[model samples]
Target chain A: MLADIEEFYRLDRLPHIWCPGCGNGIVLACLVKAIKELKYDQDKTVVVSGIGCSSRASAYLDFNTLHTTHGRALAFATGIKLAKPELNIFVITGDGDSSAIGGNHLIHAARRNIDLNVVIFNNNIYGMTGGQYSPLTPKVQKATTAPYGTIERPFDLAKLVEAAGATYVARSTAYHTRLTTELIINGAKNKGFSVTEVISQCPVSYGRRNRFNTPAAMLEWQREMAVPVIKARSMAPEELEGKIITGELYRGHAPEYVSEYTKLTQRLKEEAEGV
Target chain B: MPKDPANIGKPEVAIKDSWCKGCGICVALCPKKVLVMNAQGKAVVACPEKCVGCKMCAEHCPDYAITVEVE
Candidate 1:
């Protein structure tokens, strides 16, 4: 299909490297749609990805995309945001890439409140590296490393980022495509460290091990478990058991890092001129 | 001259077969069952007439193989 989005993608990279039913593709699509909706200059938009199946998106997208070291997408994106604050920066990362290997960077970036839009593709496992359990993998979910279900609790990434001081934080799943796209758009518009954790499906790895039989079944599970932010507020703790909250979880207005830095430098320059 | 008057302004469900991974996500999520997986494991437009133009299949294809345009 020669759709409008076709131009935003590297046509030669047709049929992305993602596996069949990989939710990474859906998230990627949502991201591109967000960019389109915002009318952001493709030339001025930068897409940064860390090492993983999700990181492979950089190669397929036609914009200025950087496929960086494992779990360092945020660092690279931070540098880009600081150096070229005029550009719209986006980080596409997996749960393992961001929360496990890049956990420190994720929190630090959020604390700084940089104008970086991050979409964590939380597929719950290290899919590209053979189904190893990740920091976001639910407790008791079986993985290659955890042959008999893990005892450790998974990180609530949205809450973690919100607590870490991100100006905008949201969560959505692949099943909620429209909402995912909308949240991504809002995340980009937040003008500070914005995190949109998308609960994606790793059918080949996380799904089969977890007995989700098929990718469609995994998507269906997301649909059943998801509750909008408004609905979640009324539900009691016990009633919200096993429910995934979707939608804009938090939005705080804070001075963006790059802009603040520019102001500081401008002030310093004026002082130097006065001297 | 358009051959089918009923087909006028119908939603266009375009499936790029080469890119389809035969995931059947579009078929499964389609509210109208307008798509089905072919014998070759690729998604195909089974009932173009039944399309409701929701674009659920297009949005969730994961493969980006389906593009539905509602005229």
Candidate 2:
């Protein structure tokens, strides 16, 4: 049984849709590793995703999956949670699909502290649809939509989730393979809502438009951007600029939606028995 | 570590010449440096020995002309 899980997660799915050196494959591997480590009831684990290159996850993973409309993954995932609270729901989306079109769903899901694991593949562009600007595309970065440079500020996903009331939040990149896997594993184990933002690379669209011409260069950028959170605390904001921060951004305990509702029902049962 | 280029499987990385569009994205991003743009501006696996099967070319190719298959 364990062997089945291991073999299923192999990188044999080529030719992959992402660029050859793109980090989405690495992030996908880490996610599968986390899922295997948890040994959650595979039948009960549902992978819900929206439209984008990252959203292609549903087609590859061997689990109950729902490939929903663009930026509506969270809405469908919410319905799944409300109907089958016992199941472990995971929402896989891209920076644009989730943060731009699906932003409200993301905030409300976190606000409820729902028992869902959200993995945002932040490649900084709308890759699957075509090279386009996304909400998380860094300021001044070149994209198909932004020929000269992007003017809008990017969203710091980890902080956004924490602010929205997600119980557990972490950040990692495709370059940090082991660390990313660990974060996903921990996020899956958390009882309440968990979010793991995986900063992946879009070598074809994002990299080519920008100065990063090679996959190695893209990988190097991921390495250079990452700043361990413990070290980030003491460093100046200037030091943190152009650097990716990877680690447990925030983790707190909250009454999980399903468990709390179950408790409420149990308490009502006890009161009725006394009557 | 020096990547063993010959150890990369497949006799020779071949791209359907007609399918190629002279997009140098593959030439720029290949970690193995196996591909190069010929005078026709078409991507060719000039140094198949350097390929690592990382799939960067096939992944980056906008036209889906590149294929990395195992022999």
**Candidate maximizing TM-score:** 1
**In model 2 chain B, which range of ten residues has the least summed lDDT?**
B56-65
Q: Which residues of candidate 1, in runs, are more than 4 Å off?
A: B1-3
Candidate 2: tens digits of C-alpha lDDT, residues B1-71: 54367554543456867656564657876777888889886778888766777765654454345767544
lDDT score for residue B8 of model 2: 48
- What fraction of the native alpha-carbon contacts across the interface, defined at 8 angstroms, is recovered by model 2? 0.02
- Predicted chain B of candidate 2, TM-score versus the true chain B: 0.77
Candidate 1 matches the true fold with a TM-score of: 0.97
lDDT of 2 at A206: 90
Worst 10 residues of 2 chain A by lDDT: A1-10
Candidate 1 docking DockQ: 0.71
Q: Report the C-alpha lDDT of model 2 over A204-240, residue by residue, as the tens digit.
A: 8899999986765776678788999999999999888
- lDDT on C-alpha atoms for all candidate structures: 0.92, 0.79
Chain A TM-scores of all predicted models? 0.98, 0.91
Chain B alone, model 1: TM-score? 0.90
